[model samples]
Target: MDSVKLGLKENWKQFALLVIVNGFVGGMVGMERSIFPQFAEVEFGVASKTAILAFITAFGISKAVANYYTGKLANKFGRRTLLLFGWLLAIPVPFMLIYAPSWTFVIIANILLGLSQGLTWSSTVVMKIDLVGEKDRGFAMGLNEFAGYFAVGIVAFITGYVANSYGITPYPFYIGVFLSIVGFLLTLFWVKDTRDFVKKEGKNNKTVELKNVFLETTFKNKTLSSVTQAGLINNLNDGMIWGLLPMVLFSLNFDNENIGIITAIYPAVWGIGQLFTGKMSDHYSKKGMLFWGMLMQGIAILFIPYSSEFAVLAGLSAILGLGTALVYPTFLATIAQATSPQQRAESIGTFRLWRDLGYAFGAIISGVTADIFGVEYAILTIASLTIMSSLIIKFRMPVNIKTVRK
Candidate 1:
């Protein structure tokens, strides 16, 4: 216990490993990012957008549920235990995707994928925070997110290329198989638990404990609730993009390669931009960052439907990604700041539960809206909601948030 010094430098080796592990985590999701909805339309004879997007709805709900439990059980069962189990559970996902006989199988695969991600990704996040302690907390989160999202971009592009060259089904999902194996091996052999570090940090920590972390993070605590809502909306819009944007690009008559490129643009910029934006969170105002970042996302999403020009669409995608980068790291940091160290995992889990549920909410909202209206109107709808989310942050979040731990 005495040997476990907290801070990034103190545990760079383990920290770096976790970052790599998270990259694999991101890659698992990236497998279907560019092609999944299209895959549904092409392979399954599934016509309704809502039916096509059922996979996402399933993924989001299952992942959201897993996230809350991971946080609740992290300390009890051990972070490393959850991490390893996540990777183990993930091993069958790609194989399922590869041989899926029906859309039912695809939906089942995503349910498993979501559970693994909630456990693995959430574990890595909590572990990184534990290892880094306070001073470079934001920066550490930046690197962690950068790895995950950058991998998402990379793998999404690769899978897109594979889908373009080969077919969409089995080949692209092979990436998932490889990623799952490597991720599992790495965690099984190398990843260490950080519960001790959490205990170490908790001893000196003095952030105010909420009467009920789940309730407060969900909607009770002013600053935290504000950030939580923003996070949910952030993912909500992101879910819209994930489920609909590729289809929009397809409607524009873009080739699969080009669709991949355009689709990859947002997450690539998002992932890389966080390399800096994460550090910026340490020095900047969380409220300002959250407000403006979300506003940019709303504005960029609005422009997406208006543009058919390839370059213009790509530019808007970049803007959307940049907006996400601004708030993504800041969201976690602000949550950490507001909660007691003893309860950090639970609060984060609760926040993530709401945040990831946006995927389901986004899929349903955008899917139904697109079916009733048009794709353009659906984009407009989510854009308006995103802007509304930003306003909540602006008006609801305190200027000088009382988060300085005692």
Candidate 2:
């Protein structure tokens, strides 16, 4: 007799725990979101956009590598081991950030942060897919991302306020210390490996196996490749927002507290909107959702530099968030549906590799462009690329078929 169960309720305990762990994972990243770009300039005396965005570059490169390996290794070593190791890398990140002597040290800290995020976040994503099986993968991914990013919004907002009150260095990073320790303890004691669940799910999934998963997920296969490019551009715009948004807000005369609030609004809306959109993937056409989501995002980003008023900026931020929410979880769900369970983790990891590399590309492209052509052109340029991405998905990708466990 084979043992396999699908649906969120059956695995709620483990599902919920993974969600909690991922929240901490997200919080770890969020700690820097609102503060770091400006911190690089003001405290460290870094002036160039390229130099200021160096941390994001390091993080994207390292995390992309980690994401690729975590997928390859999750099955061999077990998800629990990767999760713990990720936290171990995180242990030193806060201290390094808090006590850094110069900008070089900060860049090193972000590299470690990248390692932690890749390992822990990837492990949690694979684990949740394992637990929920196939029927509710969209909802599962949505909830998972919601937990992580909502924490990101909350932490970003809090750290901003903390920086405003007590100065940017040392104080704002204290939350990282707390998150790392708590996340480690929880994973060590509560998280369980779900590799068996994946095997069980695979037995039920009758999809054709992927040959050369790396090639298929990357470019050889049309649908997988299409999804891959869209994911990359999605994060590319995100990377732009991470490094440019605060600078834009600051230029408009917003204080740290206001910057934080405005920044928080984007992820907050992104995190919250997924509750419905995730499930929508289950019932609607994946291609249609991806098309419109990217469209909305491109339009929102194009208009960001035009709005200097705080209220208008905040509303635009929320619209950007909505666009992201529509597609973020759908990316994972589409990959999960496209490949056999045997290849799902690897494919997902490969997708994430390109997706996260967007952070680096986005940062570099936007940063250097802003340096040369002004920030508005940088914004306009990425927006045009985003629209191109949407067109690619619309014309190239096949409709993703919905599936469920036996």
Candidate 3:
């Protein structure tokens, strides 16, 4: 514990920068959750339902491709360089949205945003694992997630307000541009390379072949495979929440602020609750943590359709957040524990690829369901899927009941 504390103190500045950049990245991705449906409707003259589906499809496909490549890029160019480049690529996203001449342009922006998300956000997770080492990994991951999702919640609310007040739907994208540029500059100037950590493990001599890395070690690890499956379900629900929640609230005739508050709670609670959950995972069973977290998330999803009032919906959102809080870091911890240091980036990258693919799948599935059956039914359908996912993990994954001895 003392050693962990010392490492944290030694690297606090870099961690802080990482938190800021990660948070901004999260906010940039999440900002459109509340407003994009309207943007498609108002700006592009498309049907609300069709535009939402288009946006989700674009993001999902782009992110999946980017995730596949980001690990290799990080390995070849170094984590810091890829991280910086990802943010730099994001600088034009908001400008494109704000000035988009057509719905096609919005699709282009989402593609770029997806690429940025996969490269930057995925790298941050791997980087944190590299910096913190195994013993203190859960806490580090929690802190990282807390920063990212807190920014998501706060920025969602603020952007909702901006959109409502100014009647300009593109304002949030403008904010994304500013934040991405700042984050890019910070990465370029402040963040350090983590390749040294892998070198310390004496595996630096292994040649990195981008093509076969995903098919090789990453897919073969039992623990990583379990977490990857779990991550898919977890992120599928996340995609549903982000892609459909605002549409749900809008259907309920809630104001933009209400939508913002509700949308914010899911990630905020997930983020804040991780402070304790991550620590608990470090001292307890990672699989158990994941199981219970998924269970809670499943139960929480069951409540969403039933909660029509603002406060009730907010409470349910927090519940969903708690479930998310418990599972995300545990999944990351499992990946760290399961892989060799030399393979961690590739493993993390592959893990993210499957997880983000869930987003693509979730978005399309939930979007079509919502379009056909209504958003409430879509929420219920996803809740059922979450329940099934929890059952699968509970039965199939190894439940690490023993903790690492200090």
lDDT of 3 by residue, 1-406 (tens): 2233224556678777787889888888767866777677767777656457678778877887787677667778888877887887899888888888988988998999899888888788877777766568888888888888788888888888888888656566778877887888888878887766656542333333333446643455445666787788888888888877777788799978778788888888888898888788788888788888888998998888777899898998999999999998888777766656666677778888888888877888788888888787888888888888788778877666322221
- lDDT over C-alpha atoms for residue 324 of model 2: 94
Q: Candidate order by lDDT, highest to lowest?
A: 1, 2, 3
Poorest lDDT segment (10 consecutive residues) of candidate 2: 397-406
lDDT of 2 by residue, 238-333 (tens): 889999999999888899999999999999899998888899987899889899999999999999978989999999999999999999999999
lDDT, residue 296, model 3: 91
lDDT of 1 by residue, 140-178 (tens): 888989999989989989999999999987899999989
Q: What is the lDDT of candidate 2?
A: 0.91
Displacement of residue 375 (Cα, Å) in model 3 is 2.6
Query: Against the unseen true structure, what C-alpha lDDT does each candidate score?
Result: 0.91, 0.91, 0.78
Per-prediction TM-score to the true structure, in the order listed: 0.99, 0.97, 0.91
> Candidate 1, after superposition: displacement of residue 134 in Å?
1.0
